[model samples]
Target: MAVVAIDKKDLLAFVGKALDDGELARLVTDLGMPVEKITESEVQVDITPNRPDMFSAEGLGRAISSLAGIKTGLRNYSATDSGVSVSVERSVKKVRPYIAAAIARNVKMDDALVKSLVALQEKLHDTLGRRRRKVAIGFTDFNKLKPPFTYKAVKPDESPFIPLGQSEPWTPARILKELKQGQDYGYILEGHGQYPLICDSEGNVIALPPIITAEMVKITPSTRDVFIDVTGTSQHAVHECLKIICCALADRGAQIQSVNINYGKKTLTTPDLSPLKTMLPIRTVNKILGMDFTTEQIKEYLERMGHGVEIKEKGKLSVVSPTYRNDIFQEIDLAEDVAIAFGYNNFEPILPQFSSIGKRSPSDVRAGLIRDLMIGFGFTEVLAPYITNRATNFEKPMLGEHPAIHIKNPLTENFTMFRSWCIPSLLEILAASKDQKMPQKIFEVGHAAILVDGKPVEQEKLAAAICDPKTSFNEMRSIVEGVAYELGLKLEFAGLDSHPTFIPGRAVEIIMDGKPIGVFGEIHPQVLNNFGIEQPVTAFELKLA
Candidate 1:
């Protein structure tokens, strides 16, 4: 989601209506843009990243007006050919290949409109433009430029222009280092021997894009005609952005003109404002919405949402979305548009089929009994968090041969890994309570995820630790034996040589019914030192499975 801030005055003008804050919020929400916060002067709306057309005041205002009945049906915009041609050089194919340009004439300019244009360009660059990596936009004063432009790959020092926000001219290489916009977006062109450069017929630089535009031909409130160029590695993205800009300006009463894009021997005109037709499944819409809407009614709803709909009586709708819109693809998209136009608040709520039953299972009973048994053994039950770091989870290289599970993108390093064993947490509890008393005995019965066959397998275990100067391997073994006997399990212990977290000869594998359950041992000196615990620790863990 992207947040778009619109001046109330500008939005109201484009909407062709003056709305109170509450009404405006409700109206925009029904138009597929969720309102964030609306004041009397500004509206901050959460624009879905997919709806770049809805990311601007004019683009969304057009849709909103139609949905609110202030405006309706498809708006036919007119454009005249500017006869401007931008030649594509073969060297740019490996750099920034595609270039689609357009001219918007008779644009009614004002300070609010200028700011809106800037905001719309930034939103496109951040979202569908992919931070200018896949696409970048360039806007210039149309009257100041000559016809027949050239988009080519040039050496950084070969093309120099006064970049926007700067007074002096700068080379593309220097701009990447000295200019903040360049420094932030410089990585996109790293290691490239040549950079993308756009210029007019007389070789006056238009822009050094995916970076910054020229200051000489910048847009202002007085600029009536606007020239827009979209250059990138992807032809689709470049065309998509160009269409969005052209339509947004057209909504403001500007004429769109296509620019001839010369690619070696072939030529193509840009900013194709023609609507793309798609099939809308009426059956899927009815089934998903749980309401049978007639084709005419659905058409009305789609029209109100700014879409052109034609019903073929073939179980699907012949749908057409505006050129500025790129998010509509599947049946669900039409259903959503219909729902939005139908008003989400108007839908009747229905409760689910059945309520979930709340009851304790056998595992809960066993866990409760084990918890009580540990308390009965004079050990305090402690609870710990499930998320932990690597050092705390696997000091002994973990789960025999398998590594412990770790989070892919943790918000903080403190919660970077999953717990593979409970003994480490028990030791941490002792270290935190070291200042309290001479002897600290704690136990925990919790779930841990251990790696098995290269995948994390979650299992429940009962782990207890006695941290005291006199605690020994015998004490830990007796505690485990007593707990197993109380649980009605015949337990046997076999000597385990060379354990990582325990003394080599003092550890033994706890087995029951010929299956190894866990290990009990005197905590190794190195392990105790790693956790900063001075007391000798003896611990035992048992698999509840």
Candidate 2:
């Protein structure tokens, strides 16, 4: 989510209605955006990434007007041919491939409008642009540049221009090495042989794509015409970015003009302000929202959300959303809008009917008994996460790798696989709690996962550890025997030798009905060194079910 601040006066002026702070906050909150705070100067609201069209004050005003009934239905804009063309060279086809551009004439640039434009560009760059890797936007004074612009890729040494806020010209390589922005975003072009560049007819560099714009031509309060260029790897995102900027400018009394993009084989015009059409079935709306809405009511609700709706049949509607709205993809999106328009609090809550009464399972009952038993023995129960790394579970614990379920697309290295045992997690907790007082005892009762025939299998297990200077294998064995006595099960112990995680000849395997269930022993000194713990530890594990 992105938080944006809009001037109080500018918001009211664009909305074309008078609203106090309380009313304004309520309206935006009802539309699913919470107002963070409202001061005397501005109102701050958190905007979701899906609604990038509402990132600016003008965009918010447009939406507020429709929802408040001051102005309803989809607002349309017409683009006239500017005759200014941009030529796409084959060199750039592999670098930063797609580009969309437009021109805005007679733009009324005030301090408020200028601030709004800057904020919109930065917000878009941070969100949809993926920090400028997926998309980048550039703005310049249109009167300074000539027509028939060229967008191409060139060697780093060949592209030299004065970057913004600098007086001397710098090569592309120098910019990447010296400038702050280049250092921050230069990784996007790390392995490319050439860099993307945009220049005017006279070879005056307009901008270095995904980097910095030229210092010669800049937009200011006196500039009446503006040039907008959006370049990125995605065709859909580039076009959508252009449409959003054009619509935002148009809302500020600017005349939008389309530019011709020449791709050597075909020509295309940018800033297409046409609406996207889709069908919404009445039954889907009713089923999703859990209420029946009349055709007229649905039409009104869609219109309130700035959509054009037509009753095409008995139980269907032909709904068209504005081009700036890139969030709509299916019928459920329209139903969400209907819910918003009808007010989420107005819906009634109903109890769902079930086939039978619910009760605790046998495993749950046994788990409760074990929890009580552990607490009665003065052991603190701890719950560890199911997701853990191999280093903490295997390498540090002196246990070699085993078949554990791993994540295919892990976001980070810290959490890449499921834990195969509970002992490692308990040890990790003790390692972090070394600063506390001595004689710490902890236990965990949870599921451990393992692979069988290439499929994951979970088993219920209980593990306990006592970290104290006097802790020994005999103390742990006594506790294990007490647990078996409470559960009314006769158990036998067999001496274990040469265990990798425990001391040799000091660990014993617990048996029930002539089948080995688990082991209990004193942790090896080398294992304590691996976990950075200075105290000795005695631990035991048992398979509960």
Candidate 3:
């Protein structure tokens, strides 16, 4: 959640009328942004992360007006062709690849407006922008910039400009060394040879983005027209943030003009403000809210909550949500809007009819018992993340390319897939703690997944490892035998050979019900070298159920 302070006067001005203190609090609360405090000059509200639109006074006021029945339904925002364009060069493709831009003409700027805009920009950067990792927003005085613009990349030392609040020009390398923002976000471009830059036709730098904008085009009280630029790694987030800012400026009476973004091969216009169309089933509304609402009542509630609704079929309505509303995704989201419009406080509370207590399942009980047994055996339990990289889970363990679940768009190289077994994770623990004392005994009771016939099958697994100069395969085998005896089960150990992850002559497989259920062995010297573990290591892994 993001807490924002809106100037009371500015809020009411965008609200289109005066609202008393009580009315203001109640209205904002009804609109889902709970008022933190209502003071004479400002109103503080906690806006949910999902509603990035409400981070600004203008957007919050628009929502208040809608809930107050002053102005409701879908707000139509149109953009005229500004005849200005930005050329996106291929050099930035491996850096910050996407850029979305627009021009808001006839913007009436003031001290309050300037502060609000700055606050909105920073709020967006901290929240929706993922601290500028995914998105970054920049604004400038439109008249100060000479277009068409170039959004490209350059060597860090090639271009130099005065960043915002700085008087002297500094190269991108120097800025990252001296500026606070650069210090906080320079890691985003740490290993890159070039940095993302936006400049005008005259070779004047506009921004070193995800960091700071140039000072030459700073917005001021006297600034009339505003130029907006959003750059990011995610194309969807960049475009959505552009639409949000453009719509907010439009609410302040600015005329939004679209700018063409030219990729090497194609051109596209930005700030697409067309409302997204989706179907909202009437029965879904009734089912979720547990209230009998007729089709007309539902439509009215939707419109009151700022949605354009039209009867579609026998039981569905075609809903058009405002472009600035990034929260609506499905019929259930529309249903939530209807509930908000109907007033959540109006719903009567009732006791649930069913009577049953919640308790852990039998599998959980067994897992807990095993964890206790490991702790009693003087082994510290280590919980590792299920998502591990291929190198650590497969390559380093000397089990090359075994099937497991893979993440489609992994955020980083370290987290790419689910572990197929617990031994690799236990080895990871020992690898990270190599500097600790000689004796390290650890255990993990978790789930591991493997692909069976191209489908994932997951099972609970228990793995334990002992790392020391004196540890041996017999020690791990003894611990496994103790666990089996505690569980009142008979197990047979069979000599195993040529296992890739274990020493060929020192491994044994445990058999139960005439089938091999587990293995305990001295880890292979090659595997130990892969993980940089110098001491001898013995480990065992088995299915719990």
Worst 10 residues of 3 by lDDT: 407-416
Which tens-of-lDDT digit does each residue in 123-238 have in candidate 3?
88877787788789999999999999999999989898999999999999998887998999999888999999999999999999889999999988788899999999888889
lDDT of each: 0.85, 0.89, 0.90
Q: What TM-score does each of the candidates earn?
A: 0.66, 0.71, 0.77
| The candidate that achieves the highest TM-score relative to the unseen native structure | 3
When sorted by lDDT, best at the front, the candidate numbers are: 3, 2, 1
Question: What residue pairs are clashing in model 3?
Answer: none
C-alpha RMSD values across all candidates? 9.3, 7.5, 5.7
Question: Against the correct fold, how does model 1 do in TM-score?
Answer: 0.66
**Count of residue pairs whose backbone atoms collide, per candidate:** 0, 0, 0
Tens-digit lDDT string for candidate 2 (1-545) = 89999888888887889999899998899889989999998989998878888899888988888898888898987799999999999998888998999999999888988999989998888777877777899999999898789999989888699999999999988888789989998998888989999999899899998998988888877899999999988777788888999999999989999999999999889988999899889889999998999989989988999999999999999998988888898889999999998889999998776678899999999999999999999899999888999898899988989889997533345677998888888888999999888799999889888899999989899999999999998899889999999999789999986667898888989899999888889998999899988999999988897
Candidate 3: which stretches are off by over 4 Å?
16-35, 348-365, 368-484, 488-545
**lDDT, residue 130, candidate 1:** 69
For candidate 3, the per-residue lDDT at 297 reads 92
User: Tens digit of lDDT per residue, candidate 1, span 1-545?
Assistant: 78999988888888888888888888987776788897878889998767788777898788878888888767665557778889988889888899998898898887777888889998888777767887899889999898788888888787788999888889999999889989999888888999989888889998888898899999887888899999887788788888888888888878889889999789888877778688888888998898889888898999997888887777778888777778777788879889989988889898766899889999999999999999999999999887888867775323243487887534344576888778888988887888878678899999889778897899899999999899998888889988988999899999997788888899999999999989999988888888888889999988898
